[model samples]
Target: MARLPVNHPARPIYRVLSGLVGLYILVFGVWGTVLTWGEPPFARDGAWALGLRANLAFALVSVIFGIVLIVGASRRGNLGHYMNLTAGVVFLVTSILMMSVLQTSANFLNFSMSTVIVSMLFGLILIGTGAYDKVGPEEHAEEARKHRFHPVAEVHRRR
Candidate 1:
């Protein structure tokens, strides 16, 4: 049985959008991993308590989410969508919480910018991808794969 109907309209858009989000996850994973070990920004900050808390919180969240997406994508192939959806929700919730915290802080805009950018961008991308996925057809995905120079599936010839 096909996973999606043949006439679905969102297949191509979903594939591309999700692919972009997957790329972003991979890139951010690498960036966060590198930052975790190197000379981190919080290291120089005199406010050790809040700085350490924020740094640890950010690192932990990134590591957890990154691992989820990477493992899901590599192992399950299509699970990246669910992983990204969850990640987007997490970003939105975290952004809201951080924004509330910033409301009473001195560096309100500066600190909030990172969370706002990350939340908004990821939310938009994931929602777009999800919307496309809702209309995507499995048959079209297969056809698109056939036309590609680098097909995703292993081609099996005559036995």
Candidate 2:
């Protein structure tokens, strides 16, 4: 099995980056909600928030997602790792799905091309953050580092 680095030296930086992303999303959602208030849930007219087209429904979902990401980024354990991973995948998948229906009535979120691009970007960032945020004791970290540098030897030792 592939092993992620534990107690990575850059974990703090990644966490802070993830938190910044969450903050952006949170602010975007709140701003979108305010700008799109009293509009139809999926109105595709001409409502833009933070450079992305949004509707009431999309803004509401963004609020929830933003909050989840913020909470996850604040956690100091594997919870953040797992949450980031999950959120990354969700963002990627949602972006693709929304992109496919960009010009169709089925685009309930009223997503624009810019939104898709931003979502994909955020997804990649979150995944990268998650990949390096795993925490472990020094022994495990040392073992993981060894395995990373000497895969064959580590594999043989495991067996």
Candidate 3:
């Protein structure tokens, strides 16, 4: 059971950042999709969009993911927290998985080193946003703040 901040002061900023990342992903996906139109889903034809190598398959997936992120960011509940966390992990894992097969035929996403780096960066950002975007009642928030530096004592007190 990990403890997270409640009603964090920087919540708005994190939400905005999350939205921006989603916008970038959406734009990249749309551009990539148009550029890779009429090509094979996994073609290695060297198409680039927003500095990331992409193919039809990857582009379509990005579109969906981007939409999800945007929706999550726009929400005013914990949905964004969960979504960001999940997206962050997914991005991180995908970057590593793709990087592993960078030069092999298994690189169906046509990922380049740049793509891996960007994905990793996005992952970390999303995770950070998720960490501090939780919302709760004022009382809970006050308790959280009081225990911010002594979580063990807080847990014991709760028990």
Best by lDDT: 3
Give per-residue CA lDDT, model 3, range 50-101, as digits (tens).
Answer: 8999999999999988999999999999999999999999989998997999
lDDT of all predictions, in order shown? 0.49, 0.90, 0.93
Task: Specify the poorest-scoring 10-residue window by lDDT in model 3.
Answer: 145-154
Local distance difference test, candidate 3: 0.93
Could you list the CA RMSD of all candidates, in the order they appear? 11.6, 3.6, 3.9
lDDT string for model 1 (25-117, tens) is 555545544544454533322222212223333444555665565454443234655655666676677667666665454432234445556
Where does model 3 exceed 4 Å of error? Answer: 149-159
Model 2 lDDT per residue over 1-159, tens place? 988999999998998988888888988899999999998887887788889988888888888888999999899999999999988998899889989999988987888999999999999999999999999899999999888879787777799
> Would you estimate the TM-scores of all the predictions?
0.50, 0.92, 0.91
Stretches of candidate 2 exceeding 4 Å from the true structure: 151-159
lDDT of 1 at 113: 48
Q: Give the TM-score of candidate 2.
A: 0.92
